[model samples]
Target: MYHSSTFFDLLLLASATVILSLLIFLNYIRASRSKPSLPPGPRGYPFIGNVFDMPSCREWETFTEWGRRYGPITYINLAGEPFVILNSLDTTLNMLDAKSSIYSDRPTFPMLGETMGWDRGLVLSHYGERFRSFRRLLHRFMGTRAAVSQHHDVITRETHRFLVRLLASPGNLSSICGGAVVLDLVYGYKVKDHNDELVHIAEVASLEFSCAATPGAFLVDSLPFLRHFPEWFPGTGWKKLGREWRADTYKVVDTPFDYVQQRRVGFTAIEEGMSEHDADILKWAAVSIYFGEWRGSDTMVSSTSTFILAMTLYPDVMKKAQAELDAVVGSHKLPTFENSDRLPYLHALLKEVLRWAPVTPFGGHHRLMQDDIQDGHLIPEGTAVIVNMWGLLHDENIYSRPMVFDPERMHLADASLFMYIAMILAVFDITKAVDDCGRIIETKAEFTSGLVSHPAPFRCSIKPRSLEAVSLIREANLMEG
Candidate 1:
């Protein structure tokens, strides 16, 4: 008694169900054939595939633990997307360094890059002719140690200014010092004593970048189709935020660029005569140098803060460094780059700072361009590769006591860090702050979690070592001015 139309609908429904079953069977067969080749990781559920296993924060620590459990190269899938974490230096170098051609590309960041316009910067740019051009421009300017030495005076002068600021107010040395130096070098812009507009804009944009770039931060990044949704739609509030941040990001790039064009004083790769396209390349390259440093996760700022934290926690190490500074550089004048080679212990201390709390714990993620077998594991194309820099640096096999902050165990040189630490130590004594009740405030060694890591804010006493040290800091500042 059923109508003909009902019969037809039933037939169509049966046909669709059969097709879906066949497709699932085929997919299961292919996966069974390939499962043995993929790297070992935590077993995942049927459809979600390791989504629940991912940590919400401090992912580098979790990745290090995984390295301990599942070998150096560990693999995981997030809703069908493949991710590989390289936990050892050897594996990182072997894949990222040796296999540069196949691994140089960057994974697409839909939220930060496409929506917020961060892809134009060097950090997230795709690997291609434009990327090569940016590299060439940077190399021509300050790629070599010798080239860096040309700006030694600029660095020293800025460091002196920072010391003077620390003398006056002993808080937030990270942003002021890092932003000032990069601004001067990149845009010939001098930061004001308070409320620098350019610095404010850059900081805003940088924070936005960090939040948007965080993994699982935005669903739009995972589901590209969400980007096409109307802002009035439910759960599309992020689109409005993306638009606001996009404007600020452009300000970070354009404001300084326009200032340089007007003043003609900052470091510029642009020449008198060039095609518009070439000129655009030069402009972005220059901005990259500036943005890379001042972009909230500045290496200089993080390292400088780490240096303070280390000195506060280990007074014995600080006293030893001061003793060496007294004997080597003396108190009559501030330490300069020329004296770096003579201060072996100070050099070691700087190295230990870099190793103890690396600025970028998980270095930039590199995208794989093709399928390849590594260490008997099949790594498919388009895999997002991350190098666990923290794990590699803190490997117990490499260092006797990885967690301890012992400079004597280190033997490496970073010029800028050496200068910052040596200059600060020459004048300031960093110790734990004492409460009004005459009790020493305890400081635990804790750091922030992000693409760029810094020591969590802790109270510390930063003051001149002696009357003579105060005089030296003031004299150096006056001379620089």
Candidate 2:
């Protein structure tokens, strides 16, 4: 009963449907083949990829474990964000160093870097012209031949001052010495005392920024939509914190430069006839390292603090280091940079300290610029590359009993390992704390989680290595005066 035209139309419709289905089936097959390209990781939930799996604290441990289970180059997804963890040093260097051009960009944080006006920060800056400029200026001052001869006096002066400070306060004594050195280096602003208000200002700003950088710390960072909410709106504390941090960090960026200008006595980039842009580049360049944008904690302070903690935990290592110093520099004078060449054990001790507990557990987040395959896994462009320095240093295959602290591992390596080796070893005799009843207090090899993994505040009895050491510190300080 159907018309011929209608019958043909129905047949044509059926054929079209069949062809469309076939095309879709073919596409599905292709997608299935490529779906496994993403690296293997803990099977995450469908909607939230490993959100709960990402640890809020001590993530380095879990990351290393993942590396062991999966491979050196492990992958994990955090709420749709792509992350590639490089737990092996070889893989880290292969990508981040050997192929650095494509892997060196930093992960951008909207709340911390953008809203906070930290685009100027060296660590968070986009990999572009500005960053390159900052690096060049920094290299000339820090990584060049002039850096040594110029800063040697300041370092020795600070180390001696550090020894004297230990004679007074045993709690977090590294602050005065470390802060003094950085202040002198960057702004040429000599910190006459530990109570310098500028140091406190920088400390507060850096700490706030660090806490903000923690993953999953702020919902606003993940959900930019929340940023439109009112300032007084409930749960918008992150917005307020971000604003406050921005102001503080900007001041951190600007205030010191201003001080250098006012004093006109220090080595600041704010020279006559230079444009505002150039001066700003120099100012932020100093901020980049001086404040260390990642954790905002000064490198000198954190390392020095951990050195003291390490000494307290391993008295035998401290004794051996002290002996090396005594043999080289003698008790008549505190150790000098010249004595560094003769102090091999002290150099090894610094290497072990850095390895035992890295200040930057996961070195700053580096974003990939192009898609690349590593060990058969695809590292898509823009993937957040986390070089887990902690994992690399703690690899059991590389270091025997990686958890234990031992300086002897590098005794045969070389003397020129790091700068502060002989300086710290010659200064303090950090030991176990005791109560009035002469009972030893408990200490843990624990670390606090942040952009930097500083050891948690622990009780340690800090003292000078010898009475002669104390006398030397006083004599050096007076000579400088």
Candidate 3:
């Protein structure tokens, strides 16, 4: 009888286990059926899921093509992660702007943020109290046009110096001007004409950032668990690299910060007395201001470079701008912010530069905090959202002949870009370079592919429009000195 009872008990327990498993399976099926389907995208394989389909470079062009096929909002699964690409400006604004509460969060970058120590900076910082503190400090410093105008002297001086450098060595134009302006603005440290230490440090940090931040460049970014491996372990070479990059990252933040503390010069929001945490926030905020303007192609450097490239390619646009600049500011004096309102064509030209090569082809990724539905499709929580800024700017519906550089189509303006482009155009004439045979070297609108796109290096001649222009640049430089 005891043996019979044991057998019955075993059978009952087995039955209960089977019943529980069946119920759980039924619930899962029901939930799966109830859940909304994701938006249309290229079909993916079983386990990898669109990993191979993702473009290693020039992703914006691929995303744009997906937009053509799958509509404005295209969804794809990478492994288990959901990614939503917004190809239209309206959709990007609706999701990232209108629903910013959930869409403002930045995706975690294990390689760049955690290992390389970039999360301390504003660009890769997660959306939270700390991020808000950074924003608040920056806003207090230069939130408005009036606030920015307070530094007009710095801008005007650096810009004149840029003109001098361009006149001397046009080949080094890419590396010269932007760093000087930013370093002066941030630390009051005047960049040496060549081989500036601070500029080199920052440049190294920025290059590391680009490499580590590139998707799939480091295996640890995908398999974050790999970061736990010992440095001595095989295939752990990246750990050593990470250590070096982290050191550079901190150096870039601390070097100028220490300089500011020692001399008490330069613009700093950190006050005399504050809590340790508060002071740290202010420090990073100052560093952010430096990197925020200087690091990305979408900022002053790339925009100015694009302006130069545009002017070289489109002579008509350049002539129209110079005509406007001549009438408003004249050849005797370099254009100033005060003269901005008078030059409509130049304003339009600045806008065209931004639209033509959009420094950031893809806006930084925004992570979804909660599951949401839009246009009858589901965007799951933790989805990485990307806006194809290039596609939006080039959308055929929005601008006629979007590929062509036309200032007439633009109505908006960028202040820093306006200052740079207007000052340069007023003094210098940019044209295609001639070969040794005296034939004009034909160039196309080719640009580099990365987070920040810049016009590929092409031969272009940058010279003063007249001897008066050269005199004006020198006089302004001397006056600032």
Model 3: lDDT to the true structure: 0.81
Clashing pairs in 1: none
Tens-digit lDDT track for model 3 on 1-481? 9999999999999999999999999999999998888999999999667777878677778989999999999988776778889998888888888999998788877778888888887877789999899888788667877877887877778788888888888766565457676678767788877788987898788778766765557766555566788888776788888888999999988888888878888775356777889878867887788666333223577788888888889998899889999998877788998998898888888888888998778888789999998877899999888888899999999999999999898875756567788888998899999999999999888877766677787778888899999899889889988
Off by over 4 Å in 2: 1-24, 31-36, 171-175, 228-235, 293-297, 411-424
Question: What's the C-alpha lDDT at position 254 in model 2?
Answer: 84
Q: Give the clash count for each candidate.
A: 0, 0, 0
The order by descending lDDT is 1, 3, 2
- Which candidate leads the pack in lDDT? 1
The positional error of residue 138 in candidate 1, measured at the CA in angstroms, is 1.4
How do the residues 1-481 of candidate 1 rate in per-residue lDDT, one tens digit apiece?
A: 4688899999999999999999999999998887648888888877557777877678789999999999989998876778899988888888998999999898887788888988887878889998899888788767888877887887888888888888899855653457676778777888876778887887788778767766667766555566778989886788888889999989888888788888778886356887888877877787677655323226677788989999999999998998999898898988888787788899889899989998888888789999978988889999989888889999998988899999998876666667778988988899999999989999988988777787898888998999999999899888987
> Scored by Cα lDDT, where does model 2 land?
0.75
Q: Write the per-residue lDDT of candidate 2 for residues 1-481, one digit (tens) a residue.
A: 5799899999999999999999999999998887548777888877567767777788888888999898888887765678888888888888888888998788777688777887777878889998899888877766655574687787667666665566677675544445566678778877766577778787888787777777666765545556688888886787766887888888887888888888875557477899988888888887876766322235556766777788888989988988888888877766666766787888788878778988788777888998988877789888888878889999888999998989889653212224445655666667789999999998888889877677788898877766766777678778877
- TM-score of every model versus the real structure: 0.90, 0.90, 0.91
Superior by lDDT: candidate 2 or candidate 3? 3
CA lDDT, every prediction? 0.82, 0.75, 0.81
- Candidate 1, residue 40: lDDT: 81
